[model samples]
Target: MMKNRRFSIFIVIILCMVSFSDLKAQAPANDKASVKTFVQHFYDWYNVLQADDDFTRKHHLSPFAFAIKERGNYFDKPLRQAISDYFHKPLKSGETGLDFDPIAAAQDTRSGFQTGNVKQVGNTFRINLHDLPKGKSEKEILAAETFLVVVAVKVGKDWKLANFIYPAKGNMSQTDLIKLLAHQKKFGY
Candidate 1:
């Protein structure tokens, strides 16, 4: 009877270990889903900016300032400030500006659907968005455009957007763009 009880206890321990390992294995998948959702929300916000009037656009983008102010790192503060100024100030006629494009950035080159993968680099994750193919549904097209890359850093268990790069002129990463922006004192100190 004693032997049987010990064996039963051992089996239960082994089963618990296996279950925990399985949960651990699923963690990556959950993380990916979360990252994808974050990007999608950003895309949705960008779309609203594109469609809305200047006054409405500023109101829409104002919330992101809170996110940047609250969670952004040292480098991200200037970027956030620049974004805030852009929306708050009046637009100049025929002035071209940079913004995240969801369609061109997230579309799969072959599939014409939004597709991307998260690559872990040190403590950061680089989300590389693919280009959509020639033909696709309007809904899919509206879902994403010109957003090329997004950099995320893990804060506790949650991933926060550190920076994002748009494929304008050429493929420029956020790190590169921020470096350039830092030099321009007009944007922020």
Candidate 2:
């Protein structure tokens, strides 16, 4: 009777361990799915901004605050606030396009600019974009105008845009871009 009781307890412990491992394995998949959904929604929001001339910067960009970081005095303000200031600042008389178009260099994903599905690499997710048009010369297509890599980081329960890395011209990360903006005193208010 004693031996049978010990065996039953051991079996229960093993089963519980197996179940816990299974749960742990499933958690990452769930997180990935959630992050992917968040990114899709973010792009949708970005598209809407393109059409509206008076789009609210804070309203659109604040939710991803967790994704932005300040380095030294390069950016003393919060990421979203800094971006809002940058967008709302007055431009010089001759400056026509002072704003950065997030999707300007990227080929439309709906039109086959994206190479593959979003890939999770370590803590960051990478989305690749190519600047290829329909009837470009072989050299132009092979040369590839620009290769844009958008990176996202998971912050707590949400995912945030971390950087837009452009590899052609020595690879500029979001932090680097913000630093340039700060240097130029583009961040306002």
Candidate 3:
């Protein structure tokens, strides 16, 4: 009888371990879904405003900058502070603040931007934003060029925008929004 009891306890322990492992696997999948949903919602709302020239001009807004300023709550603390510091920092003679929209990495937008792949490493998620082919979705754009990458960090059970990563091109190395802001002295913003 004691042998049977010990065997039952061992089975229960094994079952518990299996159950926990399954739950652990599922947690990451749920987090990925949550990140994707959040990014998609942000881009959908942002793209509409980006395409509206009249609204932007009337409100004296650069679309992405306006979004960052007005919706500051959506960003992670460090990135938001970096942007605020950059914006408020006085420009030296012949120096310029950021001229292009860092989110889209362009001065003009065509309303074709869409959230592509979302990958998470630890607490950080790298989400690719791609420009869809004319009249076609990004899925149809065979190797669609990445416009920019949005970095989001998990914060208190939610995801918040951390930075925008522009991929390397030509002689320039890959750089992120915070780095760009901090390097104003070197790159002139």
RMSD of 2: 11.0
Instruction: Give per-model TM-scores.
Output: 0.45, 0.44, 0.77
Q: Once model 2 is optimally superposed onto the true structure by TM-score, how far is the C-alpha of residue 189 displaced, in angstroms? A: 12
Tens-place lDDT per residue, model 3, 78-181, is: 98898887777778888768878887777887556767788876568888877763366556543677768888877877789998999987797898888888
For candidate 3, report its TM-score. Answer: 0.77
TM-score of 2: 0.44
Off by over 4 Å in 3: 1-27, 133-138, 185-189
Considering every candidate listed, which one attains the maximal TM-score? 3
Segments in model 2 whose C-alpha atoms lie over 4 Å from true places: 1-30, 48-78, 93-100, 106-122, 130-147, 169-180, 186-189
| Candidate 1 TM-score, true structure as reference | 0.45
True-structure lDDT of candidate 1: 0.52
Cα deviation in Å at residue 168, candidate 1? 7.7
Superposing all C-alpha atoms, what RMSD in Å does each candidate have to the true structure?
A: 11.0, 11.0, 6.5
* Residues 93-183 of candidate 2: C-alpha lDDT, one tens digit per residue: 6664324443434322333242324577766676654454344554554455435556666655656666555554656544333453464
Best lDDT among the predictions, by candidate number: 3
The superposed Cα distance between candidate 2 and the true structure at residue 167, in angstroms, equals 3.1
Q: Which pairs clash (backbone N, Cα, C closer than 3 Å) in model 2?
A: none
